[model samples]
Target: MTLTNRQRAVPPSMFADETLMELPPPVRLTGIGLRFYVDDEGRGSATPALIRGQLWPLDTAVTDATIREHLRALVKVGYIETYSINGRKLLALTDWPSVDRGSRSRLPAPPSTEPLARSSRASRETFAVEGGGEEGREDGREEGAGEGGRGPSRDARDETEPSPFCRKHQPHGTDFACGGCASARKRHDQWLRAEAEAEAEGLAE
Candidate 1:
């Protein structure tokens, strides 16, 4: 992938540095490949790259196959996922999936983000009052944790995963209103509605 202005700031030491001088060339290639996902910009980006112009005089001699070799190793390790876009092979750091930095942090996974904590609690309360277990327990744990600040804190985790109030644990699909939409909507439902909404909005524009 090509380096963006932001990614260009990365130092060559993060990629091709003295650590290579100590290892056999093949091992060094593997090290660089392993680091593909660890580099700050790479970890924070869907597309990560070696700055074409920034690597240094020592980096010029590297071959495309060698880079690809390293990339393959990284792919095997779940460091990044390699795919082709527009017929050119591109690398995405799956460890840090989003291209948006506003969405990334050091957490193992994103935190639960429920839009309306009170509403989830109300739902949980109703579920409990109506003799529901799975729905109320799951929602209550989420809502209560959210309300009491017991769940993963914003400062402590990413906010891009399934919400803590996910209704999937509810005993029956009938429990949640079919027409209601939440950011935490049942997995397939959210995707369907959002896809349709995006399509509609695109057509409107």
Candidate 2:
């Protein structure tokens, strides 16, 4: 993935749009983030599992159902258009070229042709909900926590695997940075520091 120096734009009309205003906070935020990471043509692959992983931090336990519901909300708002190509669901942001001129260099185009095999995964997906679990639970075993004398699953604890982008913007089936994540991390750290300083000041008084 090539990193462009151009930052994503947020039009003033976004706040003015009646449809956007009616969306729930989670759905609205997710829609805006999607526009930032989608390809020049505003196309991207999204499954509930993929959305849960890429849209939220690893710790957040948003259910697939929840993600699907928000995606449906985006569709209702006309912010997204979904179609199937080769058994994969693809999303396109409507009128994307109007908002962003996009990269001059061609990236991989969205899948447009039929394939020999249809995906076994249903075109309309169904995901099993993890019942009674709190949101944002870490995927790996906590340090020194044990269960039935067995360690955490090896796959869960592995850290040697490098994610191409920061967890938030990493795309499914791809592992490469587009330089979008650095700004996010910087803002996060700044917020944390500000909170810490405010707490310190409060105690001092």
Model number with the top TM-score: 2
RMSD of 1: 16.9
In the range 50-83, model 2's lDDT, one tens digit per residue, is 7666666463657888888878887765567577
Cα deviation of 95, candidate 1, in Å: 1.5
Candidate no. 2 TM-score: 0.46
Highest lDDT among the candidates is held by which one?
2
Question: For residues 75-141, what per-residue lDDT tens digits would candidate 1 score against the true structure?
Answer: 4433345554355544544323234453344422211222334433354345346644565346455
**Model 2 spans with C-alpha error above 4 angstroms:** 1-6, 98-101, 104-205
lDDT score, residue 166, model 2? 41
Model 2: weakest 10-residue lDDT segment is: 119-128
Task: Give each model's whole-structure lDDT.
Answer: 0.38, 0.51
Displacement of residue 19 (Cα, Å) in model 1 is: 18
What lDDT score is found at residue 5 in candidate 2? 40
